[model samples]
Target: MIVITAPTGNIGRHLLPLLLEPVPDGETFRVVVRDPARLSDAVRDRVEVVTGSHGDPGTVDRAFEGADAVFWLVPPDSSLTPMDAYCGFTRPAAKALATHGVGHVVGLSALGRGTPVAGRAGLVTASLAMDDLIAETGVAYRAVACPSFFENVLEEADSIRENGVFTDSVAADRKAPLVAVADIAGVAAGLLLDRSWSGTADVPVLGPRDVSPNDLARIMTEQLGRPVRYEHQPTGEVFRTLVGHGLNEAFVQGIVDMKRAKDDGLDAGVTRTDETATPTSFEQWCTETLLPAVHG
Candidate 1:
């Protein structure tokens, strides 16, 4: 049996369907979700459902029984400090992992290394720490180290529509890898299905090309049929804007710190070789996900 968590989240929503597309013979799929109603009728009809938050040991233990491989991710929480937020979530699951004898785990993480800024990279730092805690448990682990999601642009599409502009803290010309969540999901699903590899693996899922906000704006204009522009919001304003939208102080600060690191070139570590490249392109994502979101 294979167990999944966060079945309704962005990557989870994509990963779940891939796991059940054919439902391999003699393989059982189960998901531990807080609310079963959030699952689609198709998903409910196919997989065993364990309704509860996986952060609780009781919930994880219940869903993990008779399971060999598990899909694990730490959901965001704004109430705790960065260290507590990640380590606290992983502690219970780590205990359950050892108790249940689960063999493989696939997790989500970000890319940054060997830089002073990476040491204080707020949320990125916490996520890497969480991956270590899970690694210490002796299960074979794969943390998909992703770049910023193309899906993130969806959050600012409204302002883009209204003013022909998109805003961010990253410079208009600094090149950075921006990935598609579907590609991340695709990598995770492949790893989970084939249980041959062991030890710890950090798979960097950099998208097809390096792009700046200026490049993103140009692509948006072409795809959306409007003259969109890229505007760099002041670093100080990133925090205020997030707070104005009612995000918790902890999360708001984490985002600001991450953006600062990005503007410092945290994701510039990997070059776009065939080995580091993922299949999705920003232009393609704009066509399929962005265009439909704006026009339809």
Candidate 2:
């Protein structure tokens, strides 16, 4: 049996289907979610839905009962404090896995997580800490150190749709790896099912290529049938923009620092070929998935 945590998230939504298909004979799949009512009826019917928080020891124990492998992911949001809320949530599950003797674990982590910078605290640091905790459990672990998500672009969709322009703090030409959440989930599901590797493996899910905001604008223009353009927002200006959008000051500052890190080549590593050779190309993703999203 495979237990999937955060099964309602972007990656988890795609992952559940992949896991349910091509299963070996009688192996069952289970999903751990806080609220069972939130899961789609089809998903709830297809898999065993275990209701409880990932951080609760009793809940985790029950979810991992009879489970051979697990897929783990932390919810992304500004409300979670880096060390307290984020790492605290993962630590309990990691400890539970160790006690229950689960065979494998797949974690959804981020790129440039091992590095420490002043501004980009919390999520990055907390994820790395979770990776370490999973490793200590002695279970075969694969940490999907994914790049910036392509889905994040949706946040600027309204601006592009309205003014034919998208804005960000990073330079127009600053290239960074971006990966689809589906790709990350696919790899995680594969790892959970295979169970061939041991110890901790860092799998970087790089999108087909490195791209800039300018490239994104061009792609949007072609797909939307409009003259979309990229505008570079100043670092100072980002805080106000995020605040106007209703984000807290800490969260807004963290994003600005993350963009600054991107500009300095913090997330510029090319790991698609090294980690998962079957990487998804930007054009393929844009044509098949992103284009439909814009048009629909």
Candidate 3:
């Protein structure tokens, strides 16, 4: 049996279909979710459902039972400190994996583990620490390390459509890798299905190439057939905006610190190679995903 957590989330939502398109014979799938209603009738009919927050010890205890491999993902929680949001949320699951004797685990994580700024990179630091916690379980683990997602641009679709502009806390020319959620899910699916690998490792899913905000604007302009532009927001403005939205102050600071670290090349540590590079490019994502969100 293979278990999936946060099955309704961005990466997990995409990951499920990839795993289900042609279910392996003699292999069963299970999902730990907050609401069974969120799953489609087709998916619900096929997989075992353990309803509750996966962060809860009771929920994980039930979810991990009789599981051979697990796909682990922690949903974003802006109400808590970064450590609590990542490490704390995962502590229960870590113990459950050991108790259940699950052999393999595929986890969602971020880039910047060994970088100079990793210690101060806030949320990324917490996420890497979470990887350590999982590795200690002695399960055959693969942390799908990734950079900022291309889907993040979807959050600013309105700004792009109405004002022809999108914003971020990076320099227009500073280049960094960005990946699609589907690609991240694809990597996780492969790991979950084939558990021959033993020790823990990071499978960095860098996109086709490093892209700057200016590059994003240029691509969006061409793809959307509209004059789109990039706006660089000051870190202070981002902090105030997020905090004003009633997010925890510490969480808000974590965002700011993460952005600062990214701008300083926190994600540049990994070299893009055939093994690490994913198929989707920022331009392709804009045409396929962002274009729809902006005009839909």
Q: Report backbone clashes per prediction.
A: 0, 0, 0
lDDT of 3 by residue, 1-296 (tens): 99999999999889999999899888899999989999999999999999999999999999999999999999989999999999999999999999999999999999998899999998999999999999999999899999999999999999998999899999999999999999999989988888889998999999889999999999999999999999999999999999999999999999999999999999999999999999998888888899889889
Would you estimate the TM-scores of all the predictions?
Answer: 0.96, 0.89, 0.99
For each candidate, the alpha-carbon lDDT, in order, equals 0.87, 0.77, 0.94
Candidate 1 lDDT, 1-296, residue by residue in tens: 88989999999999998889988788889999999999999999999999999998899989888888989878888776677778888899899998989899998888885566787788888888889999999999988888899999998778877888888888899988989999888888998889898999888889898899999999999989999999989868988876887777787788778889888978888677776788988889999999888765
**In model 3, what is the error at residue 215, expressed in angstroms?**
0.3
lDDT of 2 at 266: 62
The pairs that clash in candidate 2 are none
- Which of 1 and 2 is ahead in lDDT? 1
**Model 1: CA > 4 A from native:** none
> What residue runs in model 2 are displaced by over 4 Å at the alpha carbon?
113-122, 243-248, 271-278
Q: Relative to the unseen true structure, what is the C-alpha lDDT of residue 209 in candidate 1, on a scale of 0 to 100?
A: 89
Clashes of 1: 0
| Among all candidates shown, the one with the greatest TM-score | 3
Of the pair 1 and 3, which is ahead by TM-score?
A: 3
Q: Between prediction 2 and prediction 3, which has the larger TM-score?
A: 3
